[model samples]
Target chain A: MKSSVRNQFEGTIKAIVRGEAVSEIDVETAAGIMSSIITTRSMEEMGLKVGDKVTAAVKATAVFVEKA
Target chain B: MKSSVRNQFEGTIKAIVRGEAVSEIDVETAAGIMSSIITTRSMEEMGLKVGDKVTAAVKATAVFVEKA
Candidate 1:
Protein backbone atom coordinates (compact mmCIF):
# COMPACT_ATOMS: atom_id res chain seq x y z
CA MET A 1 0.00 0.00 0.00
CA LYS A 2 2.94 2.23 -0.36
CA SER A 3 4.53 2.70 -3.72
CA SER A 4 4.55 5.84 -5.76
CA VAL A 5 7.88 5.44 -7.53
CA ARG A 6 11.29 4.32 -6.41
CA ASN A 7 12.89 1.36 -8.00
CA GLN A 8 16.20 3.02 -8.54
CA PHE A 9 17.54 6.43 -9.49
CA GLU A 10 21.05 7.54 -8.69
CA GLY A 11 20.56 10.80 -10.63
CA THR A 12 21.97 13.60 -12.76
CA ILE A 13 21.17 13.61 -16.47
CA LYS A 14 18.66 16.44 -16.53
CA ALA A 15 16.81 15.97 -19.81
CA ILE A 16 16.72 14.34 -23.21
CA VAL A 17 13.77 13.86 -25.48
CA ARG A 18 14.34 12.30 -28.85
CA GLY A 19 11.90 9.78 -30.08
CA GLU A 20 11.63 7.47 -33.01
CA ALA A 21 11.38 4.25 -31.15
CA VAL A 22 11.68 5.63 -27.60
CA SER A 23 13.90 8.00 -25.66
CA GLU A 24 12.75 10.41 -23.00
CA ILE A 25 14.78 10.11 -19.83
CA ASP A 26 14.95 12.88 -17.25
CA VAL A 27 16.45 11.74 -14.00
CA GLU A 28 17.48 14.37 -11.49
CA THR A 29 16.46 13.19 -8.11
CA ALA A 30 17.76 13.92 -4.67
CA ALA A 31 14.96 13.51 -2.17
CA GLY A 32 11.90 12.11 -3.86
CA ILE A 33 10.56 12.87 -7.26
CA MET A 34 13.00 15.57 -8.05
CA SER A 35 12.23 14.35 -11.55
CA SER A 36 11.91 10.96 -13.22
CA ILE A 37 10.43 10.41 -16.64
CA ILE A 38 12.11 7.40 -18.13
CA THR A 39 11.54 5.47 -21.30
CA THR A 40 14.66 4.52 -23.02
CA ARG A 41 16.40 2.87 -25.92
CA SER A 42 19.79 3.63 -24.47
CA MET A 43 19.69 7.27 -25.61
CA GLU A 44 21.87 6.98 -28.67
CA GLU A 45 24.20 4.52 -27.02
CA MET A 46 24.40 6.29 -23.68
CA GLY A 47 25.36 9.67 -25.02
CA LEU A 48 23.19 11.29 -22.36
CA LYS A 49 23.31 14.85 -21.19
CA VAL A 50 22.84 17.77 -18.74
CA GLY A 51 25.00 16.35 -15.96
CA ASP A 52 25.34 12.63 -16.59
CA LYS A 53 25.46 10.70 -13.32
CA VAL A 54 23.19 7.86 -14.15
CA THR A 55 21.74 4.89 -12.27
CA ALA A 56 18.10 4.78 -13.33
CA ALA A 57 17.45 1.06 -13.06
CA VAL A 58 13.71 0.72 -13.17
CA LYS A 59 11.92 -2.60 -13.52
CA ALA A 60 8.85 -2.36 -11.39
CA THR A 61 6.90 -4.01 -14.16
CA ALA A 62 7.98 -1.28 -16.51
CA VAL A 63 6.03 1.13 -14.27
CA PHE A 64 2.73 2.08 -15.80
CA VAL A 65 -0.21 2.91 -13.60
CA GLU A 66 -1.73 6.07 -14.91
CA LYS A 67 -4.88 7.66 -13.50
CA ALA A 68 -3.84 11.21 -12.99
CA MET B 1 28.59 -7.83 -37.97
CA LYS B 2 25.87 -5.51 -36.78
CA SER B 3 24.73 -6.39 -33.25
CA SER B 4 24.67 -9.59 -31.26
CA VAL B 5 21.26 -9.30 -29.68
CA ARG B 6 18.14 -7.33 -30.43
CA ASN B 7 16.85 -4.65 -28.07
CA GLN B 8 13.50 -6.10 -27.12
CA PHE B 9 11.97 -9.45 -26.30
CA GLU B 10 8.23 -9.91 -26.41
CA GLY B 11 8.23 -13.46 -25.21
CA THR B 12 7.66 -15.68 -22.20
CA ILE B 13 9.42 -15.44 -18.88
CA LYS B 14 11.56 -18.55 -18.97
CA ALA B 15 13.24 -18.29 -15.57
CA ILE B 16 13.79 -16.08 -12.57
CA VAL B 17 16.52 -15.65 -9.99
CA ARG B 18 15.68 -13.73 -6.85
CA GLY B 19 18.25 -11.65 -5.12
CA GLU B 20 18.35 -9.14 -2.30
CA ALA B 21 18.27 -6.16 -4.63
CA VAL B 22 18.09 -7.26 -8.25
CA SER B 23 16.36 -10.22 -9.80
CA GLU B 24 17.75 -12.10 -12.75
CA ILE B 25 15.23 -12.63 -15.50
CA ASP B 26 15.50 -15.00 -18.41
CA VAL B 27 13.21 -14.64 -21.35
CA GLU B 28 12.74 -17.21 -24.06
CA THR B 29 12.88 -16.12 -27.67
CA ALA B 30 12.33 -17.59 -31.08
CA ALA B 31 15.60 -17.01 -32.85
CA GLY B 32 18.96 -15.24 -32.55
CA ILE B 33 19.03 -16.44 -28.98
CA MET B 34 16.69 -18.98 -27.54
CA SER B 35 17.19 -17.52 -24.08
CA SER B 36 18.35 -14.11 -23.05
CA ILE B 37 19.36 -13.31 -19.50
CA ILE B 38 18.20 -10.03 -18.08
CA THR B 39 18.09 -8.30 -14.77
CA THR B 40 14.98 -6.70 -13.38
CA ARG B 41 13.38 -5.46 -10.16
CA SER B 42 9.77 -6.12 -11.10
CA MET B 43 9.47 -9.80 -10.38
CA GLU B 44 7.79 -9.57 -6.98
CA GLU B 45 5.40 -6.85 -8.07
CA MET B 46 4.61 -8.48 -11.38
CA GLY B 47 4.72 -12.00 -10.00
CA LEU B 48 6.36 -13.19 -13.17
CA LYS B 49 7.32 -16.79 -13.88
CA VAL B 50 7.89 -19.29 -16.61
CA GLY B 51 5.52 -19.10 -19.58
CA ASP B 52 4.26 -15.64 -18.69
CA LYS B 53 4.56 -13.87 -22.01
CA VAL B 54 5.80 -10.37 -21.31
CA THR B 55 7.86 -7.78 -23.02
CA ALA B 56 11.30 -7.16 -21.65
CA ALA B 57 12.43 -3.61 -22.31
CA VAL B 58 15.96 -2.98 -21.33
CA LYS B 59 17.84 0.25 -21.57
CA ALA B 60 21.00 -0.52 -23.51
CA THR B 61 23.07 1.53 -21.13
CA ALA B 62 22.55 -0.86 -18.25
CA VAL B 63 23.76 -3.77 -20.34
CA PHE B 64 27.29 -4.20 -19.27
CA VAL B 65 29.10 -6.15 -21.95
CA GLU B 66 31.68 -8.11 -20.04
CA LYS B 67 34.75 -9.70 -21.48
CA ALA B 68 35.31 -13.37 -21.08
Candidate 2:
Protein backbone atom coordinates (compact mmCIF):
# COMPACT_ATOMS: atom_id res chain seq x y z
CA MET A 1 0.00 0.00 0.00
CA LYS A 2 1.07 3.63 -0.58
CA SER A 3 2.22 5.53 2.50
CA SER A 4 2.79 9.15 3.29
CA VAL A 5 4.95 8.33 6.31
CA ARG A 6 8.39 9.86 5.77
CA ASN A 7 10.13 7.70 8.36
CA GLN A 8 10.26 4.37 6.58
CA PHE A 9 12.48 1.60 7.91
CA GLU A 10 12.83 -1.11 5.35
CA GLY A 11 13.96 -4.35 6.90
CA THR A 12 13.35 -7.99 7.65
CA ILE A 13 11.17 -9.18 10.47
CA LYS A 14 13.38 -10.11 13.38
CA ALA A 15 10.68 -11.25 15.78
CA ILE A 16 7.00 -11.15 16.57
CA VAL A 17 5.90 -10.84 20.18
CA ARG A 18 2.21 -11.58 20.29
CA GLY A 19 -0.01 -10.29 23.02
CA GLU A 20 -3.72 -10.73 23.62
CA ALA A 21 -4.66 -7.47 21.95
CA VAL A 22 -1.54 -6.23 20.22
CA SER A 23 1.65 -7.71 18.84
CA GLU A 24 5.13 -6.29 18.51
CA ILE A 25 6.91 -6.74 15.22
CA ASP A 26 10.67 -6.25 15.55
CA VAL A 27 12.21 -5.27 12.25
CA GLU A 28 15.93 -5.30 11.54
CA THR A 29 16.68 -2.10 9.69
CA ALA A 30 19.84 -0.14 8.94
CA ALA A 31 18.98 2.10 11.85
CA GLY A 32 18.84 -1.04 14.01
CA ILE A 33 16.02 -3.19 15.34
CA MET A 34 12.80 -1.21 15.60
CA SER A 35 9.54 -2.42 17.13
CA SER A 36 6.02 -1.89 15.75
CA ILE A 37 2.80 -2.69 17.59
CA ILE A 38 -0.29 -3.82 15.73
CA THR A 39 -3.41 -5.75 16.52
CA THR A 40 -3.16 -9.51 16.63
CA ARG A 41 -5.95 -9.73 14.06
CA SER A 42 -4.05 -7.50 11.69
CA MET A 43 -0.91 -9.48 12.32
CA GLU A 44 -2.64 -12.71 11.34
CA GLU A 45 -4.41 -11.08 8.44
CA MET A 46 -1.23 -9.54 7.11
CA GLY A 47 0.47 -12.94 7.39
CA LEU A 48 3.62 -11.27 8.69
CA LYS A 49 6.27 -13.63 9.84
CA VAL A 50 9.89 -13.59 10.87
CA GLY A 51 12.30 -13.05 7.96
CA ASP A 52 9.55 -11.40 5.90
CA LYS A 53 10.41 -8.09 4.25
CA VAL A 54 8.52 -5.07 5.46
CA THR A 55 8.73 -1.33 5.81
CA ALA A 56 8.00 0.23 9.18
CA ALA A 57 6.34 3.59 8.63
CA VAL A 58 5.68 6.22 11.27
CA LYS A 59 3.39 9.12 10.52
CA ALA A 60 4.78 12.60 11.13
CA THR A 61 1.85 13.55 13.31
CA ALA A 62 2.44 10.55 15.50
CA VAL A 63 6.13 11.40 15.87
CA PHE A 64 6.96 13.15 19.10
CA VAL A 65 10.34 14.54 19.99
CA GLU A 66 11.47 15.64 23.43
CA LYS A 67 14.18 18.10 24.39
CA ALA A 68 17.35 16.24 25.09
CA MET B 1 8.79 14.59 29.86
CA LYS B 2 9.49 10.98 30.77
CA SER B 3 8.31 8.97 27.77
CA SER B 4 7.83 5.26 27.27
CA VAL B 5 8.35 5.62 23.53
CA ARG B 6 11.08 3.19 22.46
CA ASN B 7 11.93 4.70 19.06
CA GLN B 8 14.21 7.68 19.62
CA PHE B 9 16.27 9.62 17.11
CA GLU B 10 18.67 12.01 18.81
CA GLY B 11 19.56 14.92 16.62
CA THR B 12 19.73 18.67 16.23
CA ILE B 13 16.75 20.66 15.01
CA LYS B 14 17.20 21.57 11.32
CA ALA B 15 14.04 23.61 10.99
CA ILE B 16 10.53 24.23 12.27
CA VAL B 17 7.60 24.75 9.89
CA ARG B 18 4.97 26.63 11.86
CA GLY B 19 1.27 26.52 11.05
CA GLU B 20 -1.86 27.84 12.75
CA ALA B 21 -2.41 24.93 15.13
CA VAL B 22 0.45 22.60 14.49
CA SER B 23 4.10 22.81 13.43
CA GLU B 24 6.49 20.45 11.73
CA ILE B 25 9.88 19.91 13.32
CA ASP B 26 12.67 18.57 11.18
CA VAL B 27 15.64 17.02 12.95
CA GLU B 28 18.89 15.86 11.48
CA THR B 29 19.76 12.39 12.75
CA ALA B 30 22.06 9.56 11.79
CA ALA B 31 19.17 8.11 9.80
CA GLY B 32 18.67 11.48 8.05
CA ILE B 33 16.19 14.29 8.45
CA MET B 34 13.10 13.15 10.39
CA SER B 35 9.99 15.27 10.66
CA SER B 36 7.61 15.47 13.65
CA ILE B 37 4.26 17.21 13.55
CA ILE B 38 3.30 18.66 16.90
CA THR B 39 0.89 21.26 18.13
CA THR B 40 2.11 24.83 17.98
CA ARG B 41 1.46 25.21 21.70
CA SER B 42 3.75 22.33 22.48
CA MET B 43 6.35 23.72 20.13
CA GLU B 44 6.24 27.11 21.82
CA GLU B 45 6.24 25.56 25.30
CA MET B 46 9.24 23.42 24.45
CA GLY B 47 11.10 26.43 23.13
CA LEU B 48 12.57 24.38 20.32
CA LYS B 49 14.76 26.31 17.88
CA VAL B 50 17.11 25.47 15.07
CA GLY B 51 20.28 23.71 16.25
CA ASP B 52 18.61 22.65 19.50
CA LYS B 53 19.18 19.08 20.60
CA VAL B 54 16.12 16.83 20.66
CA THR B 55 15.13 13.22 20.49
CA ALA B 56 12.28 12.17 18.22
CA ALA B 57 10.24 9.48 19.93
CA VAL B 58 7.58 7.35 18.28
CA LYS B 59 5.27 5.11 20.21
CA ALA B 60 5.38 1.46 19.26
CA THR B 61 1.67 1.39 18.52
CA ALA B 62 1.97 4.37 16.24
CA VAL B 63 4.44 2.48 14.08
CA PHE B 64 2.93 0.63 11.12
CA VAL B 65 4.87 -1.63 8.82
CA GLU B 66 3.79 -2.71 5.36
CA LYS B 67 4.83 -5.81 3.48
CA ALA B 68 7.48 -4.94 0.96
Candidate 3:
Protein backbone atom coordinates (compact mmCIF):
# COMPACT_ATOMS: atom_id res chain seq x y z
CA MET A 1 0.00 0.00 0.00
CA LYS A 2 1.05 3.56 -0.78
CA SER A 3 1.86 5.72 2.21
CA SER A 4 2.58 9.38 2.79
CA VAL A 5 4.90 8.49 5.64
CA ARG A 6 8.54 9.06 4.70
CA ASN A 7 10.46 7.03 7.28
CA GLN A 8 10.19 3.30 6.87
CA PHE A 9 12.56 1.15 8.87
CA GLU A 10 12.85 -2.60 8.63
CA GLY A 11 13.24 -3.99 12.07
CA THR A 12 12.62 -6.91 14.41
CA ILE A 13 10.30 -6.81 17.36
CA LYS A 14 12.23 -6.56 20.58
CA ALA A 15 9.45 -6.31 23.13
CA ILE A 16 5.80 -5.58 23.71
CA VAL A 17 4.21 -3.93 26.71
CA ARG A 18 0.50 -4.46 26.66
CA GLY A 19 -1.82 -2.12 28.47
CA GLU A 20 -5.52 -1.97 29.03
CA ALA A 21 -6.03 0.06 25.90
CA VAL A 22 -2.73 0.74 24.24
CA SER A 23 0.24 -1.45 23.53
CA GLU A 24 3.85 -0.33 23.30
CA ILE A 25 6.01 -2.13 20.75
CA ASP A 26 9.77 -1.92 20.60
CA VAL A 27 11.36 -2.58 17.23
CA GLU A 28 15.10 -3.04 17.02
CA THR A 29 16.38 -1.28 13.93
CA ALA A 30 19.84 -0.40 12.69
CA ALA A 31 19.28 3.17 13.79
CA GLY A 32 18.10 2.05 17.21
CA ILE A 33 15.04 0.76 19.00
CA MET A 34 12.00 2.40 17.45
CA SER A 35 9.04 2.61 19.79
CA SER A 36 5.37 2.84 18.95
CA ILE A 37 2.14 3.31 20.91
CA ILE A 38 -0.90 1.73 19.33
CA THR A 39 -4.28 0.48 20.41
CA THR A 40 -4.51 -3.02 21.80
CA ARG A 41 -7.01 -3.83 19.09
CA SER A 42 -4.57 -2.84 16.39
CA MET A 43 -1.87 -4.80 18.11
CA GLU A 44 -4.05 -7.86 18.16
CA GLU A 45 -5.08 -7.30 14.57
CA MET A 46 -1.48 -7.12 13.53
CA GLY A 47 -0.68 -10.18 15.64
CA LEU A 48 2.59 -8.55 16.59
CA LYS A 49 4.98 -10.60 18.67
CA VAL A 50 8.58 -10.45 19.72
CA GLY A 51 11.09 -11.66 17.08
CA ASP A 52 8.69 -10.85 14.24
CA LYS A 53 10.02 -8.89 11.30
CA VAL A 54 8.12 -5.70 10.57
CA THR A 55 8.43 -2.35 8.93
CA ALA A 56 7.96 0.73 11.04
CA ALA A 57 6.22 3.40 9.01
CA VAL A 58 6.29 6.85 10.54
CA LYS A 59 4.33 9.75 9.22
CA ALA A 60 5.73 13.25 9.62
CA THR A 61 2.76 14.41 11.61
CA ALA A 62 3.04 11.76 14.35
CA VAL A 63 6.50 12.94 15.35
CA PHE A 64 6.74 15.49 18.14
CA VAL A 65 10.06 17.25 18.53
CA GLU A 66 11.21 19.65 21.19
CA LYS A 67 14.15 22.01 20.90
CA ALA A 68 17.36 21.04 22.62
CA MET B 1 11.48 15.77 31.88
CA LYS B 2 11.80 12.03 31.73
CA SER B 3 9.89 9.95 29.23
CA SER B 4 9.22 6.30 28.66
CA VAL B 5 9.70 6.67 24.92
CA ARG B 6 12.94 5.15 23.70
CA ASN B 7 13.61 6.59 20.24
CA GLN B 8 14.89 10.13 20.40
CA PHE B 9 16.50 11.82 17.45
CA GLU B 10 17.83 15.35 17.27
CA GLY B 11 16.60 16.98 14.12
CA THR B 12 15.59 20.22 12.45
CA ILE B 13 12.18 21.13 11.24
CA LYS B 14 11.90 20.77 7.48
CA ALA B 15 8.22 21.46 6.91
CA ILE B 16 4.83 21.61 8.55
CA VAL B 17 1.51 20.69 7.00
CA ARG B 18 -1.31 22.03 9.08
CA GLY B 19 -4.81 20.68 9.20
CA GLU B 20 -8.00 21.66 10.97
CA ALA B 21 -7.00 19.87 14.16
CA VAL B 22 -3.85 17.86 13.57
CA SER B 23 -0.58 19.02 12.05
CA GLU B 24 2.11 17.05 10.26
CA ILE B 25 5.70 18.00 10.95
CA ASP B 26 8.74 16.90 9.00
CA VAL B 27 12.02 16.69 10.89
CA GLU B 28 15.34 16.20 9.14
CA THR B 29 17.44 13.77 11.14
CA ALA B 30 20.58 11.84 10.30
CA ALA B 31 18.47 8.76 9.80
CA GLY B 32 16.17 10.62 7.44
CA ILE B 33 13.13 12.84 7.50
CA MET B 34 11.17 11.86 10.60
CA SER B 35 7.55 12.81 10.45
CA SER B 36 5.01 13.23 13.21
CA ILE B 37 1.33 13.97 13.49
CA ILE B 38 0.31 16.01 16.51
CA THR B 39 -2.51 18.19 17.62
CA THR B 40 -2.45 21.82 16.50
CA ARG B 41 -2.48 22.89 20.11
CA SER B 42 0.72 21.01 20.80
CA MET B 43 2.30 22.45 17.68
CA GLU B 44 1.39 25.98 18.76
CA GLU B 45 2.56 25.35 22.29
CA MET B 46 5.94 24.16 21.03
CA GLY B 47 6.15 27.10 18.62
CA LEU B 48 7.32 24.59 16.07
CA LYS B 49 8.35 26.08 12.74
CA VAL B 50 10.71 25.39 9.93
CA GLY B 51 14.40 25.62 10.90
CA ASP B 52 13.68 24.93 14.56
CA LYS B 53 15.78 22.33 16.34
CA VAL B 54 13.91 19.65 18.22
CA THR B 55 14.11 16.07 19.45
CA ALA B 56 11.70 13.51 18.15
CA ALA B 57 10.53 11.27 20.99
CA VAL B 58 8.58 8.25 19.89
CA LYS B 59 6.99 5.76 22.23
CA ALA B 60 6.84 2.11 21.24
CA THR B 61 3.07 2.06 21.20
CA ALA B 62 2.81 5.10 18.96
CA VAL B 63 4.71 3.39 16.17
CA PHE B 64 2.83 1.04 13.89
CA VAL B 65 4.76 -1.68 12.12
CA GLU B 66 3.61 -4.06 9.42
CA LYS B 67 5.28 -7.28 8.43
CA ALA B 68 7.12 -7.01 5.15
Please report the candidate that would top TM-score against the real structure. Answer: 2
Q: Candidate 2, A16: how far from true, in Å?
A: 1.2
Highest DockQ scorer: 2
- Colliding pairs, model 1: none
Kindly report which residue stretches of model 2 are placed more than 4 angstroms away from their true locations once superposed: none
lDDT of each: 0.56, 0.86, 0.80
Q: Put down candidate 2 lDDT per residue, A1-68, tens digits, no spaces.
A: 56567888688999999999999999887666678999999899999999999988888989887885
Off by over 4 Å in 1: A1-68, B1-6, B32-41, B62-68
Tens digits of per-residue lDDT for model 1, A1-68: 22212466577867777667666666777854344343344455556677877766454546678796
- Which stretch of 10 consecutive residues in model 1 chain B shows the poorest summed lDDT? B32-41
lDDT of 1 by residue, B15-61 (tens): 77777766666776665333433334445666667787776545454
Worst 10 residues of 2 chain B by lDDT: B1-10
Task: Give the Å shift of residue B63 in candidate 2.
Answer: 0.8
lDDT of each residue in A34-57, candidate 3, tens digit only: 888888898898889999998887
